[model samples]
Target: MTQAKADIGVYGLGTMGSALALNLAEQGFRVAVTNRETAWIGDFVKEAGPLATALIPAETLESFVSAIKTPRTILFMIPSGAPMDAMIEAVLPLLAEGDTIIDGGNADFNDTRRRFKELSGTGAHFVGMGVSGGAKGARHGPSMMVGGTQHSWDQLRPMAEAIAAKFEDDPCVAHLGPDGAGHFVKTVHNGIEYADMQMIAEVYGLLRDGAGWDAPRIGALFEGWQEGPLSSYLIEVSAAALLTVDPETGQPMVDVIVDQAGQKGTGRWTVIEALKMGESANTIEAAVGARGWSSEKSKREIAEPLLTAGTLEAAIPSETDLEAALIAARIIAHAQGFRLLGAASEEFDWSLDMVRISEIWRAGCIIRSALLDDLATAFRDEVPHGHVILSPNIAETLAQKLPSLRRVVVAGASLGTALPALSAALAWYDSTRRGRGTTNLIQAQRDFFGAHGFARTDQDGKFNAVWPDLASEGT
Candidate 1:
């Protein structure tokens, strides 16, 4: 028996887990992995190839935990929720004091909190880590979000910093806060991603229906967008997805694909959190709604019979105007996401660092973009202002881009193309700027129906009004 010490033990050897293990091995860390089956274990070991020496395979749980030294670090990359809890239960007996268990899953933040509490005082540290950038990202570089104690982070930082994607030598990884905070931010990241993708699809719909452009035509435009302010991983992939030609039919690949969008629930979770926190994540909420509506084909078919397949109404908004509008819309959507995070931070006393979040997101994430560089800079000397929009540089940019956004929204409404995300973005912007909104009538209606009472603008106290007699009612 070649008795050797392993720096870390990875308990799952699925695609992402295997890739992460390989990445760890590549960084010169001795990675021990375990799974129920031996097939993936063999495949992983063989694939490790020249780097095989750094890979350790433990078929049993006891052997896996035994391979690591004391105060051991074991990372669980299993499915979130029940499976995660089960794994923890199975591993608890083998663990020692100061040992750490990191959950690298897309877990609900509430679930993460539960796990953190369950693992507390057991002499084992629990960390909820959010790993992004998919399979390739896991193998090469990923944006890592960690929530745990300072000591737990210290133990993991060296490996994390080494493996993460770097922007100007800055690693795309952060110890966001303590317990559930990392997963919460990651959940919101996915939400912003949903909004980004949905908005892109909405824009493409406008291009297709309003401009009478085919997939390749639109794809080429998206390709062009990759070079400009809208440059990002999502935009780049969108171009690829649109441009790909199906080998079987010799047609645009995107043309044959189904329109029903698939979701994994993070987007909905974000909207739920927003509602709970009373933060207006309207742009993201609209995107999630648009996806749900897309799945109701029967309702759409029924509605389609009654609607006109309208032609181009107004001239398609200029490319320049559309791009400018997209920039502003992107800003608003991301700001809403951060707004939610800020609220969560305050509510939980997480002391979340907004700048670090943006810095890490600059690379190895679906939402990675050049814009994050600007956002990071804007947050570098943040003056405790609640919104990123309040940053002088960002405010100046929004001021410049507002006109383009207005023009695009007006054109979309006039031409009758569905721009739900864009329209919501504009509505949110407008509502934020309005010091006096038309909510007085709403208050009055509430008071009349439920006696909920209302606050007067001229007075500081809450007031209730007695029902007034009308011509239709007896005095």
Candidate 2:
């Protein structure tokens, strides 16, 4: 029996996978859909009425691979770690020369890099693509960060752009670089995502716990902010979640929900890379820490009995000031994340375009915002020399907004509400802006203890002081 060739074969049928397949089919691609569980194929095709016509359902791995034509494209929308690798191993024997395999998951860049090398000479194109915007974005359009050989990208680019969210005429997808570059960028995206969410949570706590504002009031603020520079998907979603009352309990839904945040490792990877690169991303690190702290419910419960809740009411800052603070915190966290990316680009020779990255982030992603539009403009065509916050426009913005950040931080501190992300943001901004830091003492201490030697500000060469010489002199 002869079978028709599919333009693309999607190798999974989970929520995201299904959405992606539907999206491709909607875009007029003859898509082949597959899953380890054969049941999903029936469910998918039955649910997709008109679109189902363009979709070819496959019951087995061999059938799935066979449905796609020569120089085929296979996209794996599965878990990031071992499962993704296992699928690749199983698919490799089925793939022919010049075939393309795209990983649309939150995979580690190191693994992506290694896999690219491992698949070399097999003549298969292995791409690491980072797909964002969740289920809705998948079905409609997502921000796709693709990385692989130029040949594979040439084949995938049209379809990729067609299925990606657009800002005016620009698609929210680009070939970031070679293998691992897409996932590397996505890894930092999640890190910044964590920081952004944490900052939002912190400010919400300020309104609810410190300012004595109810969920509805706090939600209103988010709704208002959505119209401004801070407008973003997370803020929009937060507004909805904050305002929702349980119809059953007639109470705020947030009040009954657990405080713990679950992480799937990408945020932690951002911090790890920042550390390895010797770059500062304390804001993101703090966000990951906040999630960790939230998860230790038993310890927090035990500590709560002995801890004193702040009794003194701190004077509430103006709503304008709080909004400014939120905006400032958001900007700082983004700067830190981009700075990390800039560092990684040098190490990996990705030649990543900050403006392009920002453009892609302007739509079809969790972090999509008006701010990203501004960033896309601010990050010029050439590689930026410093952090995004230091750019003329952003610097002026920070100069105006930073004072508000300080006031909000003071308010949060006085009221005894935790503002780790907010506080770390201010700290990162301050440290980066300062011409002189107190690190001289740190250098001196390092030299005194370990004789590591320290570079002098007054001179070009490294120098060591006659420490108390307590150990050497037997004092």
Candidate 3:
């Protein structure tokens, strides 16, 4: 074992861990790697091919620690929560002062904050880094959101930038804020992702059922969308997925797959945290609900024949209108996500920079789109009342596209097509625009039944109304 030899150490040889280690090695940084399954170490180093010289495989944790130089940096690419806690406990004894331990996983921000505090005064620093782009991105270039002490950022920034995805010439990596800010941002990122996917699926559903378009036609439509404002990795992948034929059954790949969508809990976590903060993430909530609804496959199968809501004969929307509707819904979803980020920043005192967040997300991340460039400008130049949608450029864009969204939502309602995410976005937008919403009636009802006490429009204090009992009068 070479003592104080490698630039950094990576513990865990999982898909992401291996890829990231390889990426670091390929970037000319000597990397020390180890895993619980020690047998995989030799294999991983060997598979590195010519890059093998840059990789130092350690069969044990002690040797792995010894391989890294003073003020060592170790990235743990294991599952978050209990597994991470176990790794921390195991590795803490082996580390010296000034060492940095980075949790590079989709951790719950609450857990990250807890761990961050726990590591304080212990000499070693703990960094909660949210890494996006999956395995391939890890191997090539991924967007990294780092949240820790400034000291840790100073130590990690050089290598991070070297291995990160680039937009123009800028790396898609940033020290967002302290403690758990990175993970929180990543959580909202996934929530917005859920909304984006659901909205796209809703559009596909409308085209399939209402317009009676075949898979190939829908695939072509999605392919064409890639040329415009909607050009994004998700749209490109969706087009590819739609166009793929299942060679086994000679059917569209989607046709052979089950409808039940799988979730790994990040979307649900986003909704939970948003509600806890008293913030609105309606589109994300709707997306989470849609996934839950999807899981009841048996119930849906049984109810399909038994339930019937009378469907009105609906006019199919034009492709241009559909494109406009998707763009508008996407804007609403991202705005809601950013709003939640703002609320969280206030609550946590992280002072998150929305412009930097937008800039870093423009490449490597799944939601990378041209739209984010506009959002970055909105955050940088003029976001009135802390609302991105209120920015002049975004507001003008929304004004033009919202009518198309409204038309699509109405048509979907008339067709009896489920459009939870899209409908939620439209509803949120409408509610935001309304200067006088019917919430006054809701306040009155709450005060009437629960004596919650409503504030009067004409007065400064909360007031309760004394009214006749309607039930007694009816009897």
Candidate 4:
């Protein structure tokens, strides 16, 4: 048994936990790990291979706590809700004053805030870390968002960054802000992720329904787009999936796949929080709804009769047109998603650095892409809190693509394929360009109901239109 120095302890040995542990060990950090089942620790040690030399598995939280040095740092990689709560309760008593606990899971921001307060009294620091990039990223670095006091953040930043994904040579991790800001940003990230995935799914639907394309053909088209403006990790993976053929049946595999989708609750939680914040996240909500609806495929199929059940008959658009539309729509979707993220950062008073956030997403994060590098560049050159869509570079990109985006939205709607995100993206572009054209209807509605003052079209001053008296009275 190695005496615990200033080593980090990782509690939970699931896919994420194990990968993170391995990375930490590889970086020469003495790592103490514990799981409910002792056998899992053994499995982690074996999986870690050569890095296992630095790993020390503890049988219990008390043992783990006892082994670690003062100001010990422990990362919780368990599921959210009860399990997380239980782990905190079990470990808090064992931890000394000034020790730190990091929740490196998809925990609720509010919960993190509460935990911070709860643990602060005991002199233990609490950090809410939003980890992105799935299993692969976890094992080989991922983008990390951390929120805590400056002191605690300073202590942990090196380790966090060391294990994070990077853009170019820079780590894509940042000290998000105080309290629950990290988790909040992460929550919004998941929301955007949900919207992004749905957008891709909608594009696939358009290819299948409107273009009457087979999976292999659609996959090939996506592969081609990967070299153009629409290039992205998601698009690349989707193309690969499309190209996959079933060995036994020798057909396009996607055609026979089930429509059911799975969600990890973060997206739904983001929608709920957005409502609480009085923020517009229509695209994200629609995406979540789409996933939920997909889960009821049997019911949907039975209730909504298909008029034409044979192979798709609609004509596919020319490759040039399709590529142009896809790129345009993707840009718009990214804009809308990032706009929502910006709004959330403001609402939560997170003071998040959009540039660093974008940089992180450019690599190790699930939403990482070449496009995000452009966003990061735009952010670095602009003021913090500046609207991303209004950034000179982004605006130019949007202007260049707007026409094609409009065409794609029209085509998707006419074909009766669900493209909520794409539709919302088009709406965002239109709304921003019209310069208050979208606000007039709501302003008029307010005047009709409560007689709220309205801004004059000809001038900048606010004015209230008078209405004739309706109630009769002796004057």
**Top TM-score prediction, candidate number:** 3
For each candidate, what is the lDDT? Answer: 0.90, 0.90, 0.93, 0.79
Prediction 4 TM-score vs. true: 0.90
Superposition-based RMSD of candidate 4 using all C-alpha atoms, in angstroms: 3.7
Listed per candidate, the RMSD to the true structure in angstroms reads: 1.7, 1.7, 1.2, 3.7
Whichever of 2 and 3 has more lDDT, that candidate is 3
- lDDT by residue for model 2 over 13-53, one digit each (tens)? 89999999999999999999989888878988999999989
- Model 3, residue 280: distance off in Å is 1.1
> Per model, how many backbone clashes are there?
0, 0, 0, 1
Question: Could you give candidate 1's per-residue lDDT for residues 140-193 as a string of tens digits?
Answer: 999999998887898899989998999989999999999999999999999999
RMSD of model 2 against the true structure: 1.7
TM-score, prediction 3:
0.98
Per-residue alpha-carbon lDDT of candidate 4 for residues 1-475, written as tens digits (9 for 90 to 100): 6454637888889999988988888777888889988888777778777888888888877888776767788899999878888888988878777788999999998999888888877878899999999998998988888988886787787788788876678987888888888898788888888877888888888888776778998898889888877778888889999999988799878877888999988899888987876666777888899999989988888867755534433344456766665566556656655666677678777787887778777888887777887877888888334777777877787777777767777776666776787787677667667855766888877886688989887999887777555454533
Check candidate 3 and list the clashing pairs.
none
Worst 10 residues of 1 by lDDT: 466-475
Give residue 227's error in model 3 in angstroms: 0.5
Give me the candidate number with maximum lDDT.
Answer: 3
Cα error of candidate 1 at position 328, Å: 0.5
Screening candidate 4 with a backbone cut-off below 3 angstroms (N, C-alpha, C), the clashing residue pairs are 142-165
